[model samples]
Target chain A: MTKKVATREAYGRALAELGKKNSAVVVLDADLSKSTKTADFAKVFPDRFFNMGVAEQNLMGTAAGLAAAGKIAFASTFAVFAAGRAFDQIRNSVAYNRLNVKIAATHAGITVGEDGGSHQAIEDIALMRSLPNMTVFVPADEAETAGAVEAAAQMNGPVYIRLGRAGVPPIHGEGFRFETGKAVVVREGRDAAVIATGIMVTVALEAAVTLAKEGIEVRIISMHTIKPLDVKTIVSAARETGALVTAEEHSVIGGLGGAVSEAVCENHPVPLKRLGIQDEFGESGKPDELLVKFGLTAAAIAGAVREVVKRKG
Target chain B: MENSEKELAVLKAAANEIRQDIIRMLGTAGSGHPGGSLSAADIVTALYFKFLRIDPENPKNPDRDRFILSKGHAAPVLYSALAQRGYFKREELLTLRKLGSRLQGHPDMKKLPGVDMSTGSLGQGLSAANGMALAGRLDSKDYRVYVLLGDGETQEGQVWEAAMASAHYRLDNLTAFLDHNRLQIDGPIEEVMSPEPLADKWRAFGWDVQVIDGHDMNQILQAVERALTVKGKPQMIVAETVKGKGVSFMENQAGWHGSTPNQEQTEKALAELLANKL
Candidate 1:
């Protein structure tokens, strides 16, 4: 049996470790410390932790202030509130100034489950990627989430990390290294390539395995960093595999699909199919039920790969 | 901590010069906020020249007191102060709002020297100041954090949120000044959106509130002293001021809130300021 850990849980443990190593690290939460998993950091470094009490705007601005004062501030809240509610504060105070603030937003995408569309943030990647100096990351699982947090701490500008509420299967092992703007190829194939991020990466891997049984080999690339995208790897995959399928747990409009399409269309135009929630809101259901309903399952990705391979001449 | 009569006269003269600089820069840029800039001239003057322990040569000193122009539309006032304090050449003040100028339309801390934070959007400066204050406490540093806010800007809900946090953290080292010019871009604040019973509001938010004449250098200096002696809570100095102060035609007028002065109007404003020399 494979071990499963929520990305947010990894974020909490990673932040506490960061706090221990770097005294300049401080954490802020907008009344969602327990859910966002920042409570772990709060327990260890009580003096360095600030509970901003349901004020997302103040949380972002205060984090920017702390960053300006030479402390690396990691502010956490639900993706909906952090990206939707306090966008202006993040844009003006953090990104525009290029402050060293990291916004670690958890409960991203349709995987938020039971909370429904109002709570899930399908457009967070779009909103964050549109900013001038923001670095966007959507880690695959627990290990990558930990690596991303440490990487954000070492970086010198604003970063937006999208985290999930559901536990994902750990893809990388104990010695896995993470680098920003670099995509890791989990599997190699020839017929087609599936570029995915977040929870969808593991799903893409399963789809590749399923496709391999049918004599259709597919490459699985985990394009974690959304902004400052690994265009080299994406373009290379487009060249190696004649067809491409992009998957994410977010809206198909401007998430991983849009990013891959933008790169491939300009550099190496290939037959492509995007897999995710089509431009619509998600409903209240179990996480698995939502994934199936939104066509985000492994079978759905395999179906996208088949269609794209057929369109490849 | 009182200033002598001679010192007061000098500070007043410097403030008048800053007011002239505001007009000159606005006239050169051909567009900028004048009303709030003019109103905040005296307060900024008192801070840069008298109170703040800042050295232009060492702008990023860790121990230096920090100032945030939360009401950032009044960038001209801050620019004039920075220039006068030798952060840059005083002649560079005229390059404000121009292409590729460090003196952006709003304060850009990354672009300009001696600026504590880049703040164009309203209601954010106070929170940034709170962070600085908290950092000071964490490091056991004695540097104070000062932020100036627009009276109209308090209409933003985030200001109250920051107010609550500052009090919750017991940030006694942070002091905020609300430039109560009573006017915004549209019209009078009372008619637009009332933040009235303002003193009680700050006091209720757990801040040591003080009301003073914003244009009075003596009163402004005295409030700073009083704020330092207070403990266990943050400070909010509510300063009553005219929208467009000093210039005869512009004073108390909302029309000058964001409009720039024409060349003739600029000459008249400068002459009016020059006439009030010590």
Candidate 2:
């Protein structure tokens, strides 16, 4: 079995390390410290951790306040609550002021498992990406989560880091560095490209492997930063591959798929297909089963790639 | 006793100037909220002139006290306060709500100095104040955080949420004022949505609550003094005020909530404020 780690776990570990390095770092959680994995940081730096009960609005607002006072504040909660419940605070207090606040939201997308539609934040990407001065991130695995967390701490404005509850296999080897606003090309190919984010990046990789046997030679690009989309890399991939498929564990409306769609249409028009939730909510089920049910598995991405490739020429 | 006459005289002068600035800014902008601005003038003037430990020369001094006008539509009052305190030139007050002006429709801390936070949407200031208070405790810094809120703004659920958190964290360094003008954009707060039993509500929410005349400089100073001695809990001073307190025709009228004063109305308001000067 492949070794796996939840992105949220990496975030917790990275945050603890960061707290040790930067005294200005402070963490606030809205009663989900255990699940969001911020408890790890709290255990190490109890004085800097604030548990604001179950109030997400206060959580973000308080985080903005700390940032205003020159502290790097990380406010964590489920994506639904962070992007939904406290959107006004995030928009006005954090984003409008461009405060140094990191909204490290976990349990994003349909893979929140048994939480059902109400808890699953299928629209979080659209909600956050729509805001001005908000840097949205859907980090795929441990390395990306850690890098994104560190980057958000250093950046001078509001950032939204979307982490997954389900464990994902490591995507990069040792010494892998994460750069802001840059897409990582996991594999190179000529026939088509699969641009993916979050858990869907792993699925896209698997899909590329299967397509390789089928002689499709699909390329895979892990787009970690949803906002400030790497248009250069995306346009280059579109020109080289001539066909593209976007896969995400979120709604295709405003997630990675939507972002890639806009980029490709504006700059380099290519045969493109979006593979993710079909404008619907998620139901209670195992993470894997939900992925398969929502057509977010390797086979679905593979199918999307094949369809896009056929449209080429 | 109350504040000394000489000290009150200085605050009264500053407040009278802010009220006049509010009238002039509103008259120049052709659109702004003077009702709440005039209502909050004395409290803000006292903070800017007497109480707040802030330096006009170095606005970003790390150790200086912080103040947030949480009820941000009253930006004229804050801008006037900042200008009068030399955070910016007093001439900039006339450019409020104009093109490319730092005096935005609401307070923008990023653009203007001495503004502790940017707040426009209601009910968010207390939480940000809580965060600053929390940061102060974390860093073992002695800087205090003060915020002013509108009475109608407390109708927002987040104010109550922040109140609970402030008490839970025992933020003695944080102080809040509710500008209980009892009027909002729609109508009287009681007729629209009553955040009634305001004192009881705050006390029940674990705050050291005080009710005072918001327009009285002496009362405002006294309230500030008592709130400092509060231990291990935040304080809320419920300030009862008229919507447009100083101007004769504008006082207690809901119609002035967001309306601009005409040139004649501006002259009249200015004369009244100038004559009322101590």
Candidate 3:
């Protein structure tokens, strides 16, 4: 049953539950309600769910206004539109004011597949993290995405929850807790640390399992919250492991790699190799092909870890 | 209460106080947008004093109306309105933009008392306003949401996006004021980017529209009152105003959009503002 649930569907379910609990919780979408899976919210709370059409900027601004009116607004759109098209609105209207607006941007990173680079948001985390008060999150799977949606509802201020378009595996357990700014160590190893976020967390876990067969123990940590990052977990992981590899479905320039580097720079600097899209626009393809092309597959994670461990040796 | 008579007196007094505060605050800051601030002062004054149901004493009160300054560079106007409405002490206005001052260069809702949303970047405020209005409808609350936009700010694509959404949602509880001062930081709005046929644009978007003199307290108040009577449609009040409404030499001057008044100019502006005993 869980195998078929896309993170987008989980988001819809979570939003319905959130709307039930909090009367102040309102959903706004930029005409991607069905695609982003916010249609359930619209059906359940017709008055509360607003389809702002293809206007990402208005969706952000309207969310900001709702927040000011004392509502926790979750504005939904494609990650590219939420982060790229409406960057200023999210920055000024929402984050700058510290308005309680959750940006649940779907189709994040290369997972957007055939829609191509224009729709795939590869640098959302970097863009959001750069904003002072913006809290960035990238959930790994459907269960984790559900937890993230619930968590974002409870948390104040602006939160960017990046979800993918494709049907991701239900990797996290039912009772798994998703806390803000905390890293979830999915698998433990000793030879190298594979710190990953969003959909890449699954790849990191796979890489660890594959590497374990080769007698190379790789630890996988789902660093979901990219901003206000889980430094303690990362620092200890680096210190204990001696080598590290950062993986994300975002740009190598500034997403998870940049965040992990900042943490390592402050505490324990180690031999680190970053695996992500290397600062280039993605092209139309199947999800798997895109992931492989962008070097965001389990193979890439394993290669990065092996390379980093080799450098350490 | 004679709504117009009461509103006129209130607007007359509040507008003067706001103007005085803008001049003094900008003069003291030595860096601020006085021209735009002055242009927005009267509209903000009328809204705070007459139109909106807001209590400054309990600013975060659930039922109170919300106002967002999308053109946030004009913080002095908003600060003055919030202060004059008893959100904070008038003395705080003097410390405008100073270090440790609650008032920053732009409105920061987290720091200030009555600020509905933080806005500085153009084209974001209307979206925030849409959020509030939608929230109000969701919560079964009738509290209206208001936003102020600069004429030049209308050129931003986001503003149009917000307009369409507001109308589609039939957000009758939302009212937006466009300070159609026809001037921006660089020069006149027409020269910068003509936002002309503004009313037609809003009308085409399905919003109930009104064009009025923004500085005229009676007209401003009337437009706001008329917005309430319109059912199932949002209202856009396009207020034709000078870049700087009060004070000689500054009115209609594009340079004053962001330039702080010199000490001598401050003294002169203050004198002009106080001559009417604001």
- Using DockQ as the measure, the top candidate is 2
- Of models 1 and 3, which has the larger DockQ? 1
Among incorrect, acceptable, medium and high, the docking class of model 1 is high
Q: Write the per-residue lDDT of candidate 1 for residues A157-267, one digit (tens) a residue.
A: 999999999999998867789999999898999999999999999999999999999999999999889989999999999999989999998998888899899999999
Residues B61-155, candidate 2: write the lDDT tens digits. 87889999999999999998888777878898989988999999999988988888999999999999999999888888999999999999989
The digit string of per-residue lDDT tens for model 1 on B132-206 reads 999999999999999999999999999999999999999999999999999998899999999998989999999
Off by over 4 Å in 2: none
- Candidates sorted by lDDT, best first: 1, 2, 3
Tell me the whole-model lDDT of each prediction, alpha carbons only.
0.94, 0.92, 0.86
Specify the highest-lDDT model's number.
1
Query: Each model's DockQ?
Result: 0.88, 0.90, 0.78
Candidate 1 displacement at residue A193 in angstroms:
0.6
lDDT for residue A74 in candidate 2, whole number 0-100:
94
